[model samples]
Each structure stands twice: as C-alpha cells, then as structure tokens.
Target chain A: MRIVVQEAPFDFAAEAQGFSRGLSGMGAVVTFSGLVRDDDGRLAAMEIEHYPGMTEKAIRAIAEEAQARWSLGDLLVIHRHGLLAPGETIMMVATAARHRAEAFEAAEFLMDYLKSRAPFWKKELTADGAEWVAAKDEDEAALDRW
Target chain B: MDVLYFAWVRERIGLPKERVETSAATVRELVDELRAREARYEAAFADLSALRVAVDQDLADFDAPLAGVRELAFFPPMTGG
Candidate 1:
C-alpha cells in the first residue's frame, strides 16, 4: 500500500500505470480521481487545509480497514492540498485485487471513508468571496452502504 | 496538552494551534474552559452540532475523557475527498 499527501500536483496517468504494473496474481485494477468543479464558472480556486500529523494517520487507518475487509493485492491513495484551480485534480485512489468485485468495492469503500474521515477541509474561492465547503449529509450517509 | 483547530474553527479562534494546560476531565469540560476564555472561542463553539472532536488524532465524542490525551482537535465536519 502507498499513500501520499502532497501540495504539488501529481501525474495521474504515470501513477496509475505504476500502480497497475508488476502485479503477479492481481487480475483487476480500479482507479478513481476527483477533480475540482467550477459550477457556472463562478469558482476561482479551492483552498485545502489539513492537519499535518493526523491527516496521514487517518488515511492509513482507512486504508488498513480496506485491506482487512477486501482481498486487495495493493492500493494507492494520493491527495493534494493547498490552492487548486477548477478542473485540477484533487485526489485519486486505486485498488488492485484478484477479481473485479473486490477491487471495485474496496475502491468505493476507500472513497466513502476518505470523504468524511480524512482531516482535510476545502474552502471555495469565487469572485465575490471565499466560503468553506460544507459537508453534505449524503456523503455521511454513503458510509452506511458499506 | 496541545489544542488544535481547523477550518472555520481556526479562523474564528484566530490561531491554528496552541498549548493548553487544564484539569478538565472530559472533552466537553475542556470546551467549556476554552469558551470561558474569550468571545471568539465562545462563538466558535456555540453550536456543538456543527463541530467534531478528535483526541490523540482519533475521532471521539465530546464526552471523551482527556485524562492522558496530549493532543486534541476541534473542527467542523470534514469536507475532504
């Protein structure tokens, strides 16, 4: 398992390729990337704030839980912090497993947990002003499905 | 113990982190002590429903004990992805 928390943008294609390569028994690989959305072109940028020490620990615990619940061969998580413009990549998650079911389920599980459990917060910037993004009830409800 | 705040909590409290010395037995009591310090803290902690707490970097409730905890954090519900 590999987890990265960085401020610089990552090369998603390269990272995905690297994660999928050299797999011995893994037959399926699932990858997901989150991008900043500019709704109606009002969004200027997104400022992300995170707790340094706790961010890594929280993600690791979530990843460990995914490993325990699924038959994943490997997993990769990369999340970005700091100011990001619209259409920029925010984060990505990948899971490799012996079968597609386990890989897909584990990936979804990781996303659900990361959305609510991670110690990162996002503030959206627009021409008018900046405002903190509120956590949606649906996002919290999504965890119950797992 | 070190007390940390994030997001609007930090903005409202006017600092990211601070070292706090207290004899509060629970997270709720610690919050009360902080709230008694200044209006900013009181305003930031006015709505408990909108806040979340972490003790020693792990998610916990307001009733969680702070006996041996060296780190405590308070913030709004995480908006990460």
Candidate 2:
C-alpha cells in the first residue's frame, strides 16, 4: 500500500499505468480520480489546506484499514492540496486484487474513508468571494455502511 | 504545548498556530482557558459541536486528557477525499 499527500499535480495516466504493471498475481485493478468541479462556471479556483503531519498519518491509517479488510495485492492513494484550477485532478485511488470484487470494494472503501477521515479542507473561490466548503451530512452518513 | 487551528477555526482565531503553556488537564480545560482570554477565542469556540479537536495529530474528544500531549489542533469537520 502507498499513500501520498502532496501539492504538486500528478499524472494520473502514468500513475495508473505504473500501478497496473508488475502485478503478476493481480487479476483486477480499479482506479478513481476526483476532479475540481466547475458546476456553475463561476469558479475561479479551489484552495485546499491540510495539516502537514497529520494528513499523512490519517491517510496511512485508512489505507492500512482497507488492506486489512480486503484481500488485496496492492493499493495507492494520492491526494493533492493547495491552489488548483477547475478541471484539475484533486486526488486518485487505485487498488489491485486477485479478483474484480476485492479490487472494486477496496477502492470504494478507500474513497469513503478518505472523504471524511483525512484532514484536508477545501475552499471554493468564485467571482464574488472565497467560501469554505461545508461537510455534507450525506458524506458522514456514507460511513454507516462499514 | 503547541496549539494549531485550521480552516475556519484558523481564520476565526486570526492565526495558524501558537505555543501555549497551560496547566489544563484535558482538552475541555484548555479550551476554557483560551475562551477566557479573548472574544475571538470565545467566538471561535462558542459551539463545541461545530468544532473538532485533535490531540497530538490524532482525532480526540473535548474531554480527552492532555497529559503528555505536545500538540493540539482545532478545526471544522473535514471535507477531504
């Protein structure tokens, strides 16, 4: 398992390709990427702030939990912080397992945990002003399943 | 101990982090001390339910004891992915 918390943009295609390669024992690989949404077309940018030391620790814990719960060959988590423009990739998760079910389940589990467990905060900047994105009740409730 | 704030909490507190010397035994007591200092702290901590605390970088409750804690952080609900 690998966890990366960085500010620089990552090449999703290259990362995915690298993750898929050299996994001789794995039969399935699943990857998910989150992008900065520009729903209203008025967005100027998105700013992400995160606690330096705690972010990596929290993500590692979540990734380890996913590994423990699933029979996985490998997994990767990459989350970016700081200023990002619309259409930029914010984060990505990739999971490899012996079967498709395990790969998909682990990927979803990682996404769900990372959504709430990590210490990153997002602020949306628009033409009017910048606003901190509120945490949705639905996102918290999504953890009830596990 | 070092006290840190993030997101709206940092904005409300008007600073990112600071060194705090306190005798409080728990997170609640430390919060009380901060609240007694100024209106900004009072306003920042007005609603405990709206805030989250971390002891030494691990999420903790307000009632968690501060024994041996070198760092404490306050922030809103995390919206990360």
Indicate which candidate wins on lDDT.
1
Q: Which stretches of candidate 1 lie above 4 Å from their native place? A: none
Q: What is the C-alpha lDDT of each candidate?
A: 0.96, 0.95
Model 2: DockQ against the native? 0.94
Q: Model 2, range A1-146, lDDT digits (tens) per residue?
A: 78888999999999999999999789999999999999889999999999999999999999999989998999999999999999999999999999999999989888888988899999999999999999989999989998
What is the model-wide C-alpha lDDT for candidate 1?
0.96
* Model 1, residue pairs in steric clash: none
Clash count, one per candidate: 0, 0
TM-score of chain A of each: 0.99, 0.98
